[model samples]
Target: MTSMDLSFRRSNLLRNQPIGRGDADPLPLLLGQLLLRAGLPTTIERASSRPWASALFEGRRHSIRLHFAGEEPTTQRARFIAGLSEAEWRLPKYFVADITVDEEGSDSEGQWVQLSALTIRDW
Candidate 1:
């Protein structure tokens, strides 16, 4: 009879290895483009994502917190918020089905906008 030895290794040793280049998720890039379209100096405070699926569709649901600094005039900020809700997104391999932007709150520092969106895979 022959015996075989199995060795174990630390998970962290493999964690830093690159699986592939350019295979990273494009969600961050898409979000950046959205902000750029708004033409506002925006800072992302927090973002969360979850996988979403239906009988025939699959995609992700994202909740993003954006901050517009006080430097921008109030009218411009209001226009940004209004336009963001109605703008059409042309993201690669993704289609934004629904989106909502709401004023979370504001202070002497900045204004906060909460954006919720549902993106469906196009491919």
Candidate 2:
């Protein structure tokens, strides 16, 4: 896996808050880490996110579509899902509460996997 520096800049809305008390969206960064850990040669077909918050916690619900093309795409797709499900992710300022394969299918050229995840800020 390639090394990455995952840093978040405080949103202007939280500028007046105390240090370490800001919310920076982590979905984009988290998606990169998720792809890396899966270890599949693929492209992100699409990504979507919606903000979510409760009385105490703030986070996002994410959906990602990945396309895998080449030999044995079915096998590669299986491994991709397994990798994400089994591996433990240690990301900076974020917690991946859940990640799962929501849908999958194949066409003449390749296979695609759709994943859903819930991520929360650690700060």
Candidate 3:
């Protein structure tokens, strides 16, 4: 398990909000921490939202796409999901809007993993 720092600037929309105040609040950060605790290399690139037709579509998902130092991406994904589910049960308040995991191949060869989440609400 390796730790990678994913640094990115948050949009003004997110900066002006309080901690865990909205759907797009702190899920990404919490998800990143969960991934790290699960022994996976996870990072949050950025977060933003879109407003349309009196609805607010927020991208609260932590997009984690990376190559592990010495691990298969598929295995990493599985572990991450499992860890996340467990963490979710332990911490019910923290929600992951949508989590997408991709494993192109099997075993520890040519495996690619990606995850993202979305938080939607009516504005």
Best-performing candidate as measured by TM-score = 2
Order by lDDT, highest first: 2, 1, 3
lDDT of each residue in 1-123, candidate 3, tens digit only: 998544533653486643344444454455456556546344333434332222434333344553443345556645555644334422233444445554323333334455454433323
Clashing pairs in 2: none
Deviation in Å, model 3, residue 46 alpha carbon? 8.3
Per-residue CA lDDT of candidate 2, range 45-103, in tens?
A: 89988776789887788899988885888888877777676567676777888888889
TM-score of each: 0.70, 0.73, 0.41
Clashing pairs in 1: none
Q: Is 1 or 3 the stronger prediction by lDDT?
A: 1
RMSD of 1: 6.3
**Runs of candidate 3 exceeding 4 Å displacement:** 1-28, 40-62, 71-74, 82-94, 102-111, 120-123
The best candidate by lDDT is 2
Query: How many residue pairs collide in each prediction?
Result: 0, 0, 1
List all candidate RMSDs to the true structure: 6.3, 10.6, 13.1
